[model samples]
Target: MEDVMSLEGPVLKVNGELVLIIPLSAGGDELMKCSRGISEVQGEFLKIVIPEWLAGMLGIEEGDLVCVHNTDGKFHISPSSPRRVH
Candidate 1:
């Protein structure tokens, strides 16, 4: 697996599988490039897209909540339980 751009975002499904959408304004493009991730533009935001292989490693699936940590420009993602803390 390849290193991905890091940021806090959900593990959502784009087509049928899991994908990450990292909201990064600066340095995200370069990071995505270096990490071999796809770049998507959402109006004014630049998002990083990593496929399900990475998600599979983290035991992440679509519809699951996640919190991604940025460690040295790498994606350190962790999935949260279905129960939400209100």
Candidate 2:
């Protein structure tokens, strides 16, 4: 199987709130499961979790390129990337 840079995860709810979880890895050695709102899984990549409502307002969808600016606490989502979950 071809290794992906990012993987899109299904939306789930915890405590009656919508959330989006994603599995991300850089060097393929470590796997991080990150989530928005409430997450049941503890993840190393906790920095990029985007909330569902904000994602919707920004038109962020599965496989979209989400760039997070940690310094200013802002993010930009682009629909140009065609990468998706396999």
Candidate 3:
């Protein structure tokens, strides 16, 4: 949507919560604020409450690669293990 056209920035975790501060490119060029609650944490996967609008734009589904980056550092996630499948 044009409302959230330019939403891209570093990701952060505060008080055991994940927050994404996206900047809005339209309507005043202000920052579009949004956050997702932590539903569960399993091993390397963190179940977060992703916004429907964002989900559609990102084309993310049940299982997908979600790279989390912050001032501390960055990390990448894959659906499958790095080891041999067979």
lDDT of each candidate versus the true structure: 0.57, 0.40, 0.34
Which regions of candidate 3 fall more than 4 Å away from where they truly are?
Answer: 1-47, 71-86
| Better lDDT candidate (1, 3) | 1
Each model's number of backbone clashes? 0, 0, 0
Candidate 3 residue pairs in backbone clash = none
* Candidate 1 lDDT, 40-68, residue by residue in tens: 65665555555667666666676677765
Superposition TM-score, candidate 3 onto the true structure? 0.29
What's the CA error at residue 85 for candidate 3, in Å? 27
Regions of candidate 1 where Cα sits further than 4 Å from its true position: 1-8, 22-38, 82-86
Predicted model with the maximum lDDT: 1
- Which pairs clash (backbone N, Cα, C closer than 3 Å) in model 2? none
Cα miss at 30, model 1 (Å)? 11
lDDT of 3 by residue, 13-86 (tens): 54444333322232112221221232333343333455555545554444344443222222222223123337
Candidate 3 lDDT (Cα, 0 to 1):
0.34
In candidate 2, residue 86 scores what lDDT? 80
lDDT of 2 by residue, 1-86 (tens): 53333433443454554444443343212222222333334463333344677666666555455442212222233333434548
